[model samples]
Target: MSKDAFAAAALALTAAAENGSNMCLSFLNALPVTHAAISTLGAPFGSETICASDSQAARLEELQIDFGAGPCWDALRTRAPVVDADLSEPTESAWSLLREAIRDTGILSLYSFPLAIGELNVGALDLYATTRAALNLPLIARASALADLAATPVARQVIRRLPHLDTDDTNPATYSRREVHQATGMIIAQMRVNADDAQALLRAHAFTLGRPVREVAADVVARRIKFTRDDVVDRD
Candidate 1:
């Protein structure tokens, strides 16, 4: 982290600690996209809470699984902010599926900002509400300040703690992590390689076969899909 950046973050954290604003380093799932990286209490104590909403996150994950498109996918793929302030309008084309889903849930607008230390898209923070109102300028300003202060340090910290979600449930909205990992292990064994390579092969196969990697991985576990070296070569 640059000396100036470190100084800014230290100052913000110190101020947050002093002002006693709802300061937490958890995840927010308010917008149908749960990001487990970092968050804070951003509400009026009992009136409303703006933390990430699990259902929202799950909904987004579900879109990637079901409809195969949405802001989360774009955000993760592009590593940039995706915003849809007027979902009812056709002009907002970037998040079509996400807009539909949000509409179904009675949420009218949304914003997604990717959290990155650098080139790595650590994750995204989604802020959502029921109206077209822009993010509370003050709140956004505060978050910007906080991010400016802590991003370098926090991003580095997050990277050093690679796979930050390891301590977190793989699927925060569900309890099927073990089944999935077990399936991954089976894929590795069947492919006769390490985990990362196995995962890549699985993803590549899924994209080619027009299926979800999780579904393909499950098939690997269930012995429905045989992973032969020849099959891998044949695909090539």
Candidate 2:
């Protein structure tokens, strides 16, 4: 892709972010794929298809979430691009169930790029091609770059959906609270997740218990609440 084209794509994504438009379409218009989808996977945001160019694209994401394996999962886990250039002659056996599920979907190629901000593993942006095709190194790099640009807006969209989070608060103190930061670090150390995921976990736990996030953070800081990989334990 030319620099001009890349700039145009970025502008389109910016417009979508500002107007609440479907951002996935920007990928379809800019990339070589026929379909595209963006999703939030795992904790903090949970698993959800935020946008898809078509039903098949949405189904692909759904299948990945259901089976717990797919290019999207792999991309997010490894923080790298995953490309099954020829799905009919799959290069890897990691997503057996996903391969079977998408067999007759006329999707001959699939690509996934991890979305993240620093160490925060957000989710993935997936692209699908109905005909056997490969994204060369340059295209892969471009897609990855675009995915990086898309992560912030996608994260914002998910964060806005959290009932307990006040996105409109401009008070820096609300975000810079000492207890919250301490609790987040504790969760990161306990669960082996990124800072963003750790914070989201705190908010999620607080939301579940109908308590203020600060209170939950205080509990965690006080060692009255513990976070495990599988569950949150109240030491109190």
By lDDT, the best candidate is: 2
Q: Assess candidate 1 and give its TM-score to the true structure.
A: 0.39
Residue by residue across 142-208, what tens digits does model 1's lDDT show? 4444433332233333223232223334555533556567766876776566665455455545544
lDDT of 1 at 131: 68
- The TM-scores of all predictions, comma-separated, are 0.39, 0.71
TM-score of 2: 0.71
Runs in model 2 lying further than 4 Å from the true structure:
90-92, 166-236
What is the number of backbone collisions in each predicted candidate, taken in the order shown? Answer: 11, 0
Alpha-carbon lDDT, every model: 0.45, 0.80
Error of 1 at 79 (Å): 5.1
For every candidate, C-alpha RMSD to the true structure in Å:
14.7, 7.7
- Residue-by-residue lDDT tens digits, candidate 2, 148-221: 88886787677668776434246666544788889989999997767866776676666556677887787899
Off by over 4 Å in 1: 1-51, 54-57, 60-68, 73-80, 92-94, 136-236
